[model samples]
Target: MGKAASALDYRELARRRLPHFLFEYVDGGSYGEVTLRRNIADLEAVALRQRVLNNVSEIDLSTELFGQRIRLPVGLGPIGLAGLTARRGEVQAARAAEAAGVPFCLSTVSACPLAEVAAGVTKPFWFQLYMIRDRVFMRDLMQTARGLDCSALIFTVDMPVPGSRYRDQRSGLAGAPGVLGDMRRVWQALKRPSWAWDVGIHGRPHQLGNAVPVLGNDSGLNDYFAWMSSNFDPTVTWKDLDFIRSEWNGPLIIKGILDPEDAHDAARLGADGIIVSNHGGRQLDGVQSTAVALGPIAEAVGDQLTVMADGGVRSGLDVVRLLALGAKTVLLGRAWAYALGSDGQRGVAHLLQLIEAEMRVAMALTGTTRIADLDRSKLVSAEAGANNRAAALA
Candidate 1:
């Protein structure tokens, strides 16, 4: 409602605008959320070197991703059930991303179907896939993406099974609920009158669009969740990628990679890119943060594949921090979702502009002219800080 200067501001607004269950679904992480907290903490711990007297009149934020030049090095990562956040939220987000000159990735469980989103936006958006048990469904989805002229296929490999997000259970969004729990959820939704009108009443066909062919159009939210939990194939392995590659000839990116071995394997598997992520601390609680895991994975396979990351990217400074650490580009999951939940497409567009402006200021202050020029040199090492402290003591 008020001026949202940062992503946190939008987050607060989103929390107020959305129902408790939906807000918690976007905000909460799995189990203890140790990795979730660590994601932001480690990014804050990264110190950028400051420079002065360097000409920073013009700062270029443009970069090429999968051969297309984008306005910024940021992409809106996939978020499932985004349509529930607002009226056709995924379509709004895609339109905003298109207007911002960046890519918007649509989730497999998105509220808006891929074909619908494709029709909504002028340019093609990226598609994120979850490897379910049915190979037929997966192949059909790939063909659909190709038919929609999707730019990239981001294969998410982290969620073998859904993680235990206590907040979801508490908010009555995840697990099967009793009569009282359903009543409480209904009450919560009733409290948000504007949301109730926009998403609950007008936003019809609450069914998962993409899953309709496999799960049936008559399926409800509970059925969709049950299907997702039952279908995420635990037997998925590197060899499974061969099947995906055989079906689609577009740029393939393996998401949810934290280890160097996995990055190596992704490159060997002919993946065009690898996203260093821990599913935004949703799938795995105690795993390493993307910021902490990005450097090693990037160093290992960056030359062979595009190294990107996502987690705790709340600001443009965080984006620059990721780039300095070796991420060619960064993805924003909750940040954009928060904006979408708060103010629909306008919030997302403003957030993108805010991040881009912050990145330019950060680049100017850090004496970096081009995004490609960013490296470890722009960051102050811990060892260097320790040595400086010791020298000062002496």
Candidate 2:
């Protein structure tokens, strides 16, 4: 609505614009949200080694990923029900990403189906897949992605069982079952007249698009939730990855790798890349933040696999920090979602613009000219710096 200078500003706008439940769903994390807070805190604590008098007239933020050269080393990661943020929200976000020359990944539980999104954008977007219980459905989904000419297949492996998000329960998105819950959500929607008019009424048929075949044409959010509850197979193991690798011919990236062991396993299993993420702190409550987990994982498998990281990446500064921590590229989750919720395509485009601008300034100040040159050397360890200062004072 207003000029959003930062991702947090966009988040505030989204909080004001969208219904309470929808905003909470996009913003809140699982359990006590301990990991969620750490994701941001750890990133913010990273101190950059700023250098002066270095020729930074030519700063390049461009990088190549899976054979595609992007303007920035950042991508719009998959967020389920993203379309609810705006009318044909996924389509808008995809268009924005294409314009920005970055990847926009579509979630399997997206509000719009693959065909719909494909029809909207000229370039093929990435697709994120969740391991559903039905083999037939999973195989067909892979085939569908192939048919749509998807650039990459992101196999999200961390969500064998959905995490317990208390925010969803409090916001009437979960916990309250049946008509009572539905009515509560409806009442919240009615209060946000702008959102109600834009996304609620005009954005007709608020159902999970990709899941329609299995969920039936009449299925809505509640049915989608029930389907997820019953369908997410908790018994899934790394061996199941063989099935996915067999089906997907494109660049296959394993998302949600927080451990070096898992990164090694992904590389051994023939993955093209691995995203060092914790599902935006949505899956586990007390695990290490992506910023904290990325360095070791990158050292473990950076040569064997393309190392990407995501979680608490709110600005271009954070992007630079992750790159210095060993992320070849970084993914933006809540950042883009908040912008999308605030003003749809324009908000996303503006946010990307802001990120690029911030990255340039950060790189220039740090005396880094190229994205490839950004590594641990460009950062001053906050802990070590503090200890050094304490010793000097003592």
TM-score of each: 0.98, 0.98
Candidate 1, after superposition: displacement of residue 137 in Å?
0.7
lDDT by residue (tens digit), candidate 1, 176-221? 5456666777788899999889888888788788999987877666
lDDT tens digits, residues 198-292, model 2?
99999877889999989888888788778888999899999998899889989999999999998999999899999999999899999999999
For residue 222, model 2's alpha carbon misses the true position, in angstroms, by 0.9
Error of 2 at 107 (Å): 0.4
Q: Please list all clashing residue pairs in model 1, or write none if there are none.
A: none
Q: How accurate locally, in lDDT, is each candidate?
A: 0.92, 0.94
Off by over 4 Å in 1: 178-181, 389-394
Q: For residue 12, what is the lDDT in candidate 2? A: 97
Instruction: Say which candidate scores most in TM-score.
Output: 2
Total clashing pairs in model 2: 0
